[model samples]
Target chain A: MKKHIRKTAVLSILTTVALVLSYVEAILPPIWAAVPGIKIGLPNIIIIFILYKTGLKDAITVSVIRLFLVALLFGNAMTLLYSAAGAILSIALMTLCKKINLFSMVGVSIVGGVAHNLGQILVAMAIFETSQIGYYMLVLAVTGTIAGVFVGIAASIILKRFEKIKI
Target chain B: MKNNNSQKNQKLRNDIILAVVIVFIAAAGLLLFVLTKQEGSTVAVKIDGVVTDTYPLSENREVSIKTGENDENINILTIKDGKASISEADCPDKICVETRAVSFVGETIVCLPHKIVIEITNEKTDDQIDVAV
Candidate 1:
């Protein structure tokens, strides 16, 4: 019963956090003038923290749930599809890199960020049915790397406390 | 598990390498973009993936695009000196207004919330046609 309560509490708190981050980002003004798709990706910090504290299964669950919730509440069908692709790809890369354990939190997040931008570009290409949008990827990658490093730092700091409170 | 100094050094090196590679990739991508951009004089305004209007870059004009669904929605695109840009938009984000005027082929200004796109199309030049014809 204790374990059940802990899991539920953690899940709900993380979900709420993820939602708040999404809401804040939506309302915030555009950060990068050159790249419209670029976002600070604050939600990824929560996703990464959860991944580090728990495991891949729980992490994926949280991410997918977060994506759908944000989509339904604040986005359209196309944006939903685009964001879903980015989330899945980022999570998958983060999981694989985390398993390897060769790099630090920052390095892992750098990979995740690059993969996230790639996933979004792939979806954009599919939606427009054109390869002309390739140049935009570079802009996205630059912004993603910057945002990822910030998130990685935040995640690392938060994960340090999880060790003491491990269930 | 206690990691020794060597492990720390290795991890640091890995992070450096990763960061360097991404920077290199971004630089290359930027160079490719600058080199591959084409000049186009035709601009097409599209909504919901369909073209709603087409304009020439050479003419200076103000075109106000209205969404059929929301009558109040308005995005004013302006063209001048062979370039086009969104001078004003009533959308929430107003990101389209931030984008610089574009004269190159395949360049675009997108308002995601509005589902609007303005893309430049290449115009035919007389030098390409055969003299015999």
Candidate 2:
């Protein structure tokens, strides 16, 4: 029982960290690169950590909680719906990739990033009531690929260090 | 030991396959962009959702549509007498702003959070105007 409680507590802390990082990223000025809608996806580090250390269920729980709390704090009610959709999609894709074990952490992370962006685009299309934005998907996919690889690499290093630690 | 080596070889082969797939997709996208390249002076801006205001671009009477609520405004800049290129959106990502002017048969400006999309058609051939909703 104590071990379970400890694990839950750790998960909560990680979720909080993810929420904070997401909020920070939201406030930062967007960096316009060759592709549009590209972001650093800083919160993904926490998600990847949870997936590696705990399990998929725990990681998903953390993602949902962090997304909800962040939306409540910084976004409108409608924005919550979009964010939730994107978060769920990203988590699902990453978990699936992890199950396959074909790609390393980096590969999984790239999949997650691409999935998240695509999910967001879908929601945007729904809201904007136009299909013209579909063109942007190509650019987004390319950008997501790059960002996913970077975040995945970062998470792998962190996970590797955590594994080596005796604590 | 033999099984472990074979497993490693399998993993390498899979990685190679995935890499090839990604490259192929990227190439396809680039090819599409190149093929669809258009040269026109017309610019049109579609204001997703509601159009709160229209601002003039330069002094030539070219107008840009500004959409969204007061809190989150997406401004599209249209050149060539209100035909293309919109900039300045209040969305966090600013992806729409980075998009170039749409001068081809099919081009669009999309604001996902606001449920807004601005699309350009051939104006001469396409008839149905349906918003994704």
Candidate 3:
């Protein structure tokens, strides 16, 4: 019971952190006005950390909760659809990479980032019903990779510091 | 200690490999799109996945496209000097407005919230009509 409580408390705190990071990302001005939907994916740091320290189930639970809350507060149905697709695909791929244990935390994060962008582009293509916008994926891939590297580095640092503490 | 050091090096190598692979895939996809591109002679406006209008790229003009159930949504498309762009839009994101002018075939400016797609096409009206006839 005590262990369970500790786990619950940690997850709730992490969920709140993810929510706050997402809010900060939403408020920040577009990194490049010319490019739409470009985000640093700040919330992903918490996601990666949870995946490494806790497990896949907890990470996904926090991810879905954060997505729903963020959408309800700051977005609409359309935004929710796009983000849900991205989040699902990203977490799946990230889990696969972590399970393989071949790459470091940074690598897993990069895969997650790239997968997230690809999922969103696929959703856009389906909605527009035109392959003409496919080129936009290339631009996004570059940005996503850069953002992933940063998020991965940050997650690794956090994981190292948290190792000394029990919970 | 030596064994642990080598294991760390192996993981680092794997990370570099993953990064390289993603970069290669992105580059290849970009090249494919570039090779398939050609200068378009007409601009096609699609709403709800249907072609609603077409304008010659040579003619300079501004067209206001209104959407939504009550015609509340608006996106202004401008064609000048053989290039087409969305100069204004009332959509929430304004992504279409920020997209640069497109003159090549298959290039598009899409407004997801409004379900608007402006694409450049190489098809001439005469060819389209000839095929239809």
Candidate 4:
């Protein structure tokens, strides 16, 4: 029971950290003016960390909670829809990549990042009922891969440091 | 220790392969778009997956598209000099407004928050082209 409580506490703290990171990214100026919706996906660092350190179930639970909370605090229904879709797709891909284990944490993170962007684009195409918007995916794929590398490196570093401490 | 070292090297190779594949696909898709693109003469405004209005690119006009409850959401589309753009919008993210004016076929200005899209199309008929000539 105590171990379970500790696990829950750690997950909650991680969720809060992810939420704060989302707020920080929101306050920061656009990384690139040419791409209006392009983001570094700071919260992804936490998600990747959880995926590597904890189990997939914990990672998913924390991700969902963070998504809902961030939407409530900083976004609306429309944002939630896009985010939920992206999060689901990203997590699923990350899990599959990790299961294969042919690549490192960075590889899994990259898969997650690229999948997240693809999910948003797919949702956009569905909503607009036009395949023309798929053109944006070219730009998104480049950005997503770059951002994934950054997030992956950050997560791996954190995981290494936490290896000494038992959670 | 040797096994671990080889595994790490293999993982690095795989990562490179994955990144290359993704980038290649994106580049190929972009090439396809470029090859098929043509100068468009019309802008189609789509709301909720339906084309609500169509405007000629040759004409200079401003269209205010009102949507949502009580028509609270507004996206002001401006067309001039054979290019279409969203000059103003009330959406949370003004991505559409920031997008460069589009004159080529398949170019789009999308306002996801407002469910609005401005797409360029080359739908001019032979008769219309002859008349212009």
Candidate 5:
């Protein structure tokens, strides 16, 4: 019973950390070199960490909650739909990868990242009411891979340390 | 374990293929941007559903369009002779501004929140007979 409580508390703390990281990322100046919508996706590290530590359910919960709160706080209602689409798609892809054991945390992260971009593009297309904007998808996919690999490496390090921690 | 290993390898190969395809598409887009260059088209700026200004596209120009009833200010667009680009935007993330110029058929510039869109269409002529009629 106590273990369950501890897990819940840890999940909440991790969610808070993810929220803060997302806010910080929002404030940072974007480094737009190759693509327009590309960013480092720094907040994804926390999501990856939570996925490795707790499990898929907790990770999904964290992702959905973080997305909702972040959108509300930012007051960008349109973004809420986009973020939800991306988060759900990413989590679904990561969970599938986990089930198949087709890759390590890094692999799953990469898949999630790519899926997130796909989801965002889908939303953009719907919003724009035109499919011509699909040209941007290729750029987003490449950028998503790079960001995913970075987050995956960070998740691996955190997971390793998490295994050693007693509490 | 063997099945898992093979499956993992397959997924990795798939991702690589996907990445390659994306790269090819990006390269094609870059080529297209280079190939179909045009000069000097008239651009009209609209903010929150109202026509604000019109200008000729010769060189990059940035104009600010303020959202009515809100403090939000969006860069109207950049124009360079028959080509227009979204140079900057006040909205969060500025995703629209990052979009490339509309040089091809059926291309559009959109700011969803602001309900602003600038589209490029073939000029219509009154003398042209309607084939469907």
Candidate 6:
């Protein structure tokens, strides 16, 4: 019972952290205005932390819930649709990488970020009904990889400190 | 302790391999993007999936697109110096306005809320740039 309680408490806190990071991201000015939809993906820190601490299923739960709640709070239907596709694909890729455990935290984060961009592009292609949209991701990949590094570093630091306090 | 060392070595190898792969992929994609780019001779303005106008990039002009029945959803497109960009947009994101001018074929600035698409096209032209070279 105590372990279960600890798990729930930690997950809830992680969820809140993810939610706040997302809100802060939305309010912050675009880091690169010329590139649309570019974000540092701060929420990925908590997602990665949860994945490391618990497992893939819990991490996915946290991501799906965070997406739904964020949509309700800050976005509309279109934003929701775009983010949902991105989040699902990103989580899936991260989970696969985590299962393999071949890469370090940074590499997993990079994979997640790149998958996120690819997923968003897929959604945009579907919405626009055109395949030429694939070209845009090429440009986006540069920044996405850079942002992934930032998120990976942040997650690495947090997870390290978090290890000292795991119940 | 030996097991831990091997695990660490494995992780190091994986990180190097993953980093190299991603960077290589990014470089390849960028190269393809640049190579495939063609100079656009015209800009096609589409509102709600219908082409409303095609303006020549060689011409300098400003077009105010009324995205809705009313004058509220307006996006001003500007063409100058052989490039096209959104000078103004009332959409909340202002994403269209933020995109820099595009003069390459297949480049687009889309405002999803307004259902506005500004695409650069390599339309057949009789211009000297195309004929001289």
Choose the strongest candidate by TM-score.
3
How would you encode candidate 1's per-residue C-alpha lDDT over A14-101 as one tens digit per residue? 9889989999999998776767788878888888888888878788888888888998999878778898899889999998888898
DockQ: which candidate is best?
Answer: 3
Better of 1 and 3 by lDDT: 3
TM-scores of chain A in all candidate models: 0.95, 0.92, 0.97, 0.96, 0.93, 0.94
Clashing pairs in model 1?
none
Question: For residues B24-127, could you state the per-residue lDDT of candidate 3 as single tens digits?
Answer: 88899899888977899999999988899999999999999999999999999999999999999999888799889999988888888899999999778559
DockQ of 3: 0.71
Q: Give the residue spans of candidate 6 off by over 4 A.
A: A164-167, B48-50, B69-71, B125-133
Question: B94 in model 2: Cα distance from truth in Å?
Answer: 6.9
Question: Which parts of model 4 have CA positions greater than 4 angstroms off?
Answer: B125-133
Candidates' C-alpha lDDT: 0.84, 0.68, 0.91, 0.88, 0.71, 0.85
Q: What global local distance difference test value does model 4 have?
A: 0.88
- Listed in order, each prediction's TM-score against the native is 0.87, 0.77, 0.94, 0.93, 0.74, 0.88
Model 4 lDDT at residue A11: 90
> Which pairs of residues clash in candidate 6, taking residues 3 or more apart in a chain or in different chains?
none
Q: CAPRI verdict on model 2?
A: acceptable
Ranking by lDDT: 3, 4, 6, 1, 5, 2
lDDT, residue B13, model 2 = 63
Per-residue lDDT tens digits of candidate 6, residues B1-133? 9999999788868876776777788789878888888898999987766778999999999999996777679899999999999999889989899888999988898888898888998667546668879
lDDT of 4 at A134: 80
Interface RMSD for all numbered candidates: 1.8, 3.3, 1.4, 1.4, 4.7, 2.0
Q: lDDT of candidate 6?
A: 0.85
- What local lDDT does model 6 show for residue A166? 69
TM-score of candidate 1's chain B against its reference?
0.85
Which candidate should be chosen as best, given lDDT against the real structure? Answer: 3
In model 2, the Cα lDDT at residue A44 comes to 94
